[model samples]
Target: MGQEMYAMLNQDQRSIADTILASHRTQSTTTADSCFFIDGQGIYVMTVAWTGIAASLLPEGRTVHSRFKLPVPILKTSTSSIRPNNEAPMAPCYALNAVDILLRDIMNIDAPFGGKIMILGGDFRQVLPVIRLANRSELIAASLKSSNLWPYFKVIHLHQNMRTGPGEEEFSKSLIKLGNGELTSNEDDEIELPSSYVPTLCNRTILCPKNEHSLLVNEEALQRLPETEKTYTSVDEVECEDGDDITNYPTEVLNSRTPSGMPPHKLKLKIGAIVMLLRNLDVHQGLCNGI
Candidate 1:
């Protein structure tokens, strides 16, 4: 085994990825620790938002993404936007700087993968790091750019928005100006929206003040549609070694603990119902997770 490993590590070595798999194939006990300190067994390709990573590090195990362990390798998430709030676990109360903590961890990455690079990227204009009781400046201060470790980072600026289509350069430029702080209205950081952009009908984005308001408005609009309603219920199960535990899941508890953004187990739909996908299964054809 030693000779084989020596040959594997030296002359006839495979890619680092393959070597890791080889170790797993041989049931190397240290493989798990050498990779990560978590039960990353079936979590082959995990993706999480920046704030999701931060929230997972909480000592209290109040992780909104996955069960908390410690010191997992960082990887770019599916979308890799790191745009504040998107899929992140929002924790307003648990104070202390989260971005700083995440950066500090990068600064002290231990051996085996200590040479790993951490790239932090995001647009502050979209959403500042929102702390529970923080003000505007405080929110700004919570961003990774505000951390002491930020000096060591090599910044990369993307001047172009590749997603912008033809005849939308002006619109894209307006967005760039907004992001760069070159464009602003006299109002409280509010910009004028084109009258045509605001949707009074279907097939466009509509901004609402609150979730409840959005839902209520949608419900009202859908009422006018002459489609029959169909209802579906969800199956509830508890994860436990004991077979008996699975059936013991209380409906109330299951419903309460159901993830916030997950499609409800019980769902109602009509023939002409307007439904938005929550995941991007295709990109080339513009079939993505969001809209």
Candidate 2:
């Protein structure tokens, strides 16, 4: 969508789009999943992975001459009629935000006629837009507040998760944590070590010390288990990959007490329990026997 629109923009407009697009593309591989809005310039760009229907909807390509230029309005609204209060006058307004205009004029006709619009893009976790918002929430909030027509607008939530795998999941999680100021490491705590100390070669050296420490700890724990028979019984040994044996100590422990009115045999129970019962007089009085 953005690419087609970019081709129609004038030289100055193209320059602005190029600048914004370049900045986003250089950041990370995920840069492709970003949307851009140039305020005052009235230029917006969105990129999504190829969709046949969307491509078909785009205007047919034509040769570009110096005379060719982008449309003044991406979408234009029809003139509204006035009803007398006896005939109260109503104004025809167009949605400036492209997504809002697209949805109102195209996708969902039953959507509101005019109002402030909240456009949200979650491209960071999905396909990056051709142009990305520098600050998403702030820009959306500002756009919504700018219009007083309906005073309020519907919030459009873009739901798509394109990133997969544990590494990508962890990266997204870290981004969310950082946004909420819950990042584990503080800026001041980060230390710069001498370049020579950095490990360039990754192999057994990385695991050796840590593996030895784990083995020693396991051995010490196993040695103490036999003497503590009253608390622990039957220590089973399992070999681990790092030359360490995991000692599993099993002991019978009392889990829970019987319910107040339930008999011992009838009481369904377990250790670390919580029980809930549904409402019905014919049943066990809406109480959970064991939870």
Candidate 3:
């Protein structure tokens, strides 16, 4: 990781990173190219990278499932194929519990998470475990907060909103209140929006629920724009996985498929065209998703 990115970390993020570092000073693992970091007791500590994308970005990082080999729809009897790890953000409670069980067995310690110093970061208010056909009660039961290991962990509440831009302080505060159900509303439960935000709503952009719709709208808008369109085609490739033949799938076939959150293979653009990012390329430089 860049020193500048580390320097950009706010007080809350610094505290979390510091807590991870303080676990073991003997040695630390890091990837210079990755945008995130988690450090602990040298080679023994298991660091759960935020997502598969984040893991791919890191040199040593791996997803909780990949690192532990935890089964999909993990059960109470499930145990990790490997031993040891910590610092999992946005992991479901059941998943973490499976790790805890594995660690205790490997370390031969009768302690929570085999005496590992864990730092779990995430907002319970947002993106809880998605249990199909599950009710609200079942949803809450699946949360990390409801885990038996929850009491063993010392919770650190981060109050800082690091990504809030200039003049967005009030908007940020409102968001926090909204999440907490503390925002004031009228009898109809409608909170009035600020007049200053009207200009933002007026931007010449149409939100579409699917890629096909977005492509149609984009094409229409591009044709209407008074300029020559510049077409950019991605150098698409197909790298077959182990046990899979390369000839099984053709390049043209792969290019024709546009998965969610991915730009089309043949991207057309015009000057002054509005664009949004689908991935985090350089978070420090603000080239992230939805930029």
Candidate 4:
């Protein structure tokens, strides 16, 4: 794991890792690389990244394992990492198949079941798999439901919302209805915003349809704040991996990118100011964008 990832872990997660590591070092057979056994306690703590998994399936990947003393390579699959994003289609089928083969051939598991334990988490309603240049059918096809592994999943529904504020059930139901596509107004299929959705002087937020609109609103709001403003400018650079520097991508080009994500070339804020996060940097930590 990267230092940043380790730093992001909460105390509970850190304690869990520490306890397990201590337990594995003394008595737990220490089956995995990160495992430790302590006296009579046995625990395995293997943390692998999606990119690492992809690298492991290569011929050279297996060679590295052979060179080292590996009892058996265990792989944990997270369906969230496989979901298609806006830029990519459904998870790479070849890579998935390779993993299945590795489980069967290397780990000695039956076909299809990748490892001894598979833990999957994420809400389907929140963000459907992205499929560009396609219709509803393609979008659905790119989702986990369309995969052969869907049948093995035992879907669990969470009914309670412990975080709900007073009278938030009604608001929650309204959102569910909107998500269900049950609130369309006419043939054009435009859903009317709630009466309270519009921005007001006393409202803490202004929900805009796009990031550009949001930026304008943010600037206006910041100016209205009764505090001294401080401006910070970002230094943009061309990278060999992320993008080619053949033309030395201009600062203007970088600034034109998504502000909701990729950091801005310049940022302005003030003490006691409010701002929205721009990405899912840490969900468990409640540090993701929009929160």
Candidate 5:
């Protein structure tokens, strides 16, 4: 169905579709050899070579010698997968190594020539490379030093939590607190005080239950309020035994008539509510506080 829809798109839309497809194809082939290709006069060349040295040696003596040129634009953009082991810890080795190669060989070769380099992945908290550290203390010390090669590069930390919902935002905060051993009864009290604000708790006990007899459950419930439905009478009637109710419930009633209606449930601000404000709004005024 998606393929048919994609095929039916106009020329301008098809161009975008082609660009996306090409990007996916590029990402799928992850080796240094497979990513790059030579193009000239609307002709597509081969996409892979045996090795960097082999690729450098190709343009001069090969059968396609006249067809190609040296210092071929090699794209070392995407990286291959890193496997995890029981003995080692996680680190950004493959990514760093790729960057090193890009700096030393790819970028350095055939000087006086320059090209635009763009990096488009973030969400660093989501996934990191599984690296086997030979010396942990040394690596840590090296990472800390500003003079080291690691610090020479610029890093853009993305502040926006695009993937998470309101519930997820609360859960993640709780997890951070739990990991730091700062979660206490005081924090719980703060979260569950106001009647207007519902506390979003991270139920970590469900992560690993002690015994097979014990049942683990997630307590968070999603409230969904349809535009046609005014009041949510069903919220009170529904009873969840395992606490695994994943239905989105509409907590507050929305003004269906108004186009720019208020959100069903507005987050209540407390003393220590860790809130993320929208970038454009005033940080002091428009901040919606509460986890």
Candidate 6:
């Protein structure tokens, strides 16, 4: 971090950093397992984020999955790959539980994170774990508050809205209320935004619950555009176990598929149509995931 970055931090963030630094200094001087505190076992003060974009913005930050080597298709009994191992922001309860297990096993201490000081941060009102095909009950169950260890952790409240200005405070409060489900909803299960809020085309991005709904919106927008439409189709194929292109899965089947993390086989576009990048090609060049 540079002087400019330090100066950019709000009061709350600065306070958090100062506390972490003080703890790091104390841990560094201690004789008990100094290797784990000072060196390779893990960073004295590590930062973990749920998304790669958030991690990229932080100083020496890494996504939880990469930093912890979390297993794919993680289960109740799942463990990370690292031999030994944060401001773990927006961490799901399951992910935290996995780390708790890892720390206990590696440090040979039957305690939460081997009794190491952890500063967990996140907004429960925001997004939770993304479980495919999961219902509302399942989603709630996966949150950090639902975990048994949630009670052991001390909760600190930071009430100041350091980023919001005087005029914008009410709007910010309304947004918080909306997130917390405190706002009244209509028959459509939607709450009206703040009266002062204005939606602009350039600054707004529409989010849909399902991919098909998104595609529908895109098609409708494309039709309304006063320009010629262009259709591009990707080469569709199914590779067999023997490394041969097989006709067993027809082209229509492949073309009709719109699986998560995959682009549609047939891509449609028009002049002045908005689009989003799905993967990071070069962050330095402004080409990144979710851009």
Which candidate has the top score in lDDT? 6
lDDT against true structure, model 3: 0.65
Q: What would the per-residue lDDT of candidate 4 be over residues 186-235, giving only the tens digit for each residue?
A: 77877777665444643554579998888788788888989989888877
Tens digits of per-residue lDDT, candidate 3, 1-291, equal 456776888888778667656554532222111122232213354545435544544445556776678886676577787722233435667887887788678878766666655555556555666667989998788777787876655555678776789998998888777878897899999987666756667555488998889889878888899988888888877665753766777788888988866888888888888887765465445454455
Q: Model 6 segments beyond 4 Å from truth?
A: 1-44, 83-90, 105-110, 201-213, 216-236, 239-248, 266-288
Could you tally the backbone clashes for each prediction? 2, 20, 3, 11, 8, 0
In model 2, where do residues sit more than 4 Å from their true spots? 1-120, 123-141, 144-160, 184-291
Query: Candidate 6 local accuracy as lDDT?
Result: 0.66
lDDT of 1 by residue, 137-240 (tens): 76555555554434544333445564677877887777767767787577676777555433575455578876656766777777787988888787766778
Model 5: residues with Cα > 4 Å off, grouped in runs: 1-95, 109-147, 176-291
What ranking emerges by lDDT with the best candidate at the front? 6, 3, 4, 1, 2, 5
Task: Assess candidate 4 and give its TM-score to the true structure.
Answer: 0.49
For all candidates in order, the CA lDDT equals: 0.44, 0.32, 0.65, 0.46, 0.30, 0.66
Decreasing TM-score order of the candidates: 6, 3, 4, 1, 5, 2
Better of 4 and 6 by lDDT: 6
Better of 1 and 4 by lDDT: 4
Clashes by residue pair, model 1: 279-289, 280-289
In model 3, the worst 10-residue window by lDDT is 27-36
**Candidate 3: regions farther than 4 A off:** 1-46, 53-61, 83-89, 185-291
Q: Write the per-residue lDDT of candidate 6 for residues 124-180, one digit (tens) a residue.
A: 666677788989998788777787767665554556777688788888888788877
Top-TM-score candidate index: 6
In terms of lDDT, model 4 sits at 0.46
lDDT of 5 by residue, 227-282 (tens): 23223222222355645452533233332211211222223334332334322132
Ten-residue stretch with the least lDDT total in model 2: 82-91
Give the winner by lDDT: 1 or 2.
1
Which TM-score value belongs to model 5?
0.26
